[model samples]
Target: MKKRSHISILSAVLVASVALTGCAGGNSSAGGNNASGGSSTPPAQTQPSTSGSSGGTAAPANGGVIKIATQTPLSGNQSSLGDAIKTGAEYALNKRKEEFKALGFDIQLFPQDDQADPKIGVSNAEMLISDPDVYGVVGHLNSGVAIPSSVKYEEGKLVMVSPANTAVKLTEEGKKTVHRICARDDAQGPKAAMYAKNTLGVKTAFIIHDKTAYGQGLGDQVKMQFEKDGVQLLGYEGITQGEKDYSAVLNQVTAKNPDIIFFGGLYPEGGILIKQAREKGYKGYFMGGDGLDSSDMIKIAGPAVEGVVFTSVAGDVTQTEEGKKWADEYKKTTNKPLETYSVYGYDSMNVILNGVLEAIKANGGNKPTREQVLDSVHKTKDFQGQFTKVTFDDKGDNTNADVFIYKYDKEQSNFVGKAQ
Candidate 1:
């Protein structure tokens, strides 16, 4: 097998850039410091050239079918986010269809709606893994759903790469088949807490979660970080997800007069909480994790969500030159502006597809086994895609990951200004 050193090459480049920037002793401007690091020119987006002819290994006697499955909530409250994941994955597959066809394989996408429910996600996983053609999956947007579903994938030796699952436990469980392209909540939570204390100047905070694995885990991470930073916690609560009214919780939170309110949940409940909190006279800053990154937050909260800030595991891809091109293509293809996780979805699918190609090459153009594909993915390093350079650690977490903060700008009618 050919050994690649792209991961080391990128790491050295980043280190040298940081060293040079430090020697200059100049502060990065707003546009220069977009995310966790100062802006540096990104490498051009071009497919890596393939080497060798299809010879050594046994060629597939006949053309085969390769299917990539996506499990997300295509209906229910989180459908907006689910739809973005589906669109992003589908876009990547569609763009690469010709390439796969040239390799004597027909690539197809099978998207299953899990409704953000663990049981439903597990069922989807069972169905996907049962099909021999379904070699990999690109989804399960919710960590709660992903955790259970990934178990089934592991049992079946099917690779499951996530674009949006941020909970620490997802990658920490030591499952080789489970991998994520996004930063973990532990990394994201501290940045958000620091922003609250130093940037927002919030002295006290009230925290709430939706009681799911993603929500509760992220909320705990933020809470721990905030307490360490000397921010007084007025209250910490978990509410039922589908409840229509939250006046009782808002009344309680308002009584404490917190300087900021942080909800560790998705847009559906977070939006209502913000709206009701504003209506009940709690004029404080609101913050959340990537679960609240969807435009639905603003749509549901209306004017109340103006100036609301959230931390996303994925940064603003549109800011980068390559990202702008990708954004244009995505809009032209999907007819909708790319959401926060859409780039992540695109990147995740590319990672899997890249691994599949490598696996095929390693087998000398023969149809590779599921285990070969899994091994190829495990060896991925510095696999550049539209979102960012991906290099998964031993724990299946992306080592180059960083959390970015974005604020909803009512005037601009969009989220602007990425902050570390």
Candidate 2:
């Protein structure tokens, strides 16, 4: 088990950069200053483009399978997450397969398990690139997977819509090719940091990461925000993900005796670490990013997950109108509820298809070339999504989305949204 502090420090730098910019102007939106648009905006109005029931203008039959690839953690420590992603995408495709057929095309989803490792993610991305049929991709649940995987897709002119990857740098430069439907780590990190400071009233905190790119990046972001708010950072460090035992790290966190502990990583490691922390007599707020929001965490942490807090970008997407319909239909078709990245995965399909549909209409229903589809995705603006408005800035990130905070309610056996 190896731990490096470099990524943790990088996250701190991310916060400092935002804070310094704030000093130049009275703007507070830089480092989590409550920028969630007040709920005055009405739900967005983008409609599905299914063909008319009657024999309407049929799309020119291309008779080719359009592939949408995914790189996820399907069979490793992160399999829980990978499974969610695959299910979500399939749900979306199955629901809308007819719509695509009506448009004279057949769309197929291609999933690859990256196992939450960067090297494997890159390998998977290259394999997808070699496959000529893959027009767009839907995943790489971990930010570490998304960051590098994106480079290959971008060079290959493939549209990438990330349902869960949320690191800031992924879309920082306004990438035209890579689009993310979920909020980024910077968004989630600041929201969690603010909750700890203003809502939880925590004065000192211990921040830790799993030493992976995503974990360390989020840990750094939270630490920087805590420091900006003048909260005492008792200690900050990194841990190795997938370690059998975290007793040594738990011993250190317990000695610090901080009011809260912020972990930046996924469930398999988080579940075990939180359980160990509680067993070792550390009673404080335990929190992490969306990676720790899965039901499996409760299974692993057992009673220890109770009262633990976490932030998620995908706010129980089933709560939205479109999400509800999709869940109902998915269960009717597959007898399962939408979970994890399902909302994001489905939403990604809607967005990419929306772009594809619009592109075909613009070109008079001719078979759209990959370049046309790529161009269409770039022009996506103000499309109504399952959870919220699905518009991207030049950086391939959502424009006005909110991060939600949830606490583990043992009584409910799930993370319940706190009444903010």
Candidate 3:
């Protein structure tokens, strides 16, 4: 391993010599970052609207189908993460569906693919609102998509519980309908910066963003904190989303020889950047935000991804016995391995469903309106979830929202504990 590290450093020196020459061609290098960012994602809108029941005991008139939607990307680049969130919500609703069934209501999961596109997200939001059956939505992995989609939700008075979307604007817009269980970019970014500055002990940093809402937003925060911490800012750049070659920028990054490279975007771009940068002999440490939470990065970046640390809004669920059991069940239910956001999706869905129950109770065992469900969710206080507890402030942001850091190992990323 030491020999390989030395060889890798030598190779970097050799490559650094020629990096500038090939940068203009833009063919020699790779990578951006997202929540994933189809190249981003969010949880989605699922099944129809309905009031909730308390412990299957509430005799709420008749049990009709209560559709809760998860609005996340199920296709495209970020699908790995998108699907993860969807599956979590799916498991949550499916597990408790019987409760609704006993209450004479069929609780169904309605997952909508925002495709990580803002326009598509808004359209999906409109469609879910029109359905009237979709009471609450669980998605959008991308903050860019989530922001606009949230506008539609606000206009329709539909409650949206996001498992991913971390941009501050998602909640700061004064949109009462928007809520996220995850920490915002402001909280996530600074802690990541602190980790890089204090934990990683980096002195110089290079910042790169995907040029999208979530990516740029997160990048800006990390940048502000890094500068505040007296870390030398090597260069701040933006990469086009969905692009394959990032050699030009990689060359710039390699030339500067910063102690660390920080990416603000999702897994798709992040993976490529790490892989390509490594292949091109950029041996510095790389870090990112929750957008790098997906395990798919291991496949994309291969051995190069080893030791890549990141800050995620989602916490490790396997740490606790109940969470460990839930993870195993998640694998059994989906016939697939669990990803980081799975617990988050599950919790977001449960929050919405819990709100439904409260709404039903508040309405005297009658079917409640979307407004009631919205009000109930907004009033959420100390709601215990499988992974974390939630209490939405007036801004619909989780009050206990925290940022956790993790580093990629041989098989997958492991939790390094909470950053803040």
TM-score per candidate, chains pooled: 0.85, 0.81, 0.86
Runs in model 1 lying further than 4 Å from the true structure: 1-61, 411-419
> Compared with the true structure, what per-residue lDDT tens digits does model 1 show for residues 223-315?
999999999999999888877799888888989889999988888888899889999998899998888888787778888888788888878
Instruction: Quote the RMSD, in angstroms, for model 2.
Output: 14.9
Displacement of the residue 120 alpha carbon in candidate 2, Å = 2.1
- Candidate 3: what lDDT? 0.78
Best by TM-score: 3
Model 3's TM-score against the true structure: 0.86
- Comparing 2 and 3 on TM-score, the stronger one: 3
User: Per-residue lDDT tens digits of candidate 2, residues 287-369?
Assistant: 88887867778788888888888888767755557657767876576554456566667667666766655555544444456
Residue 345 alpha-carbon offset, candidate 2, angstroms: 0.7
Q: Cα lDDT for residue 80, model 1?
A: 80
Candidate 1's displacement at residue 375, Å, is 0.5
Query: Which of the two, 1 or 3, has more TM-score?
Result: 3
* After superposition, candidate 2 runs with Cα above 4 Å error: 1-62, 320-325, 411-420
Q: Pairing residues by index, what is the TM-score of model 2?
A: 0.81
lDDT of 1: 0.74
Report the number of the highest-lDDT candidate.
Answer: 3
Ranking by lDDT: 3, 1, 2
Stretches of model 3 off by over 4 angstroms after superposition:
1-61
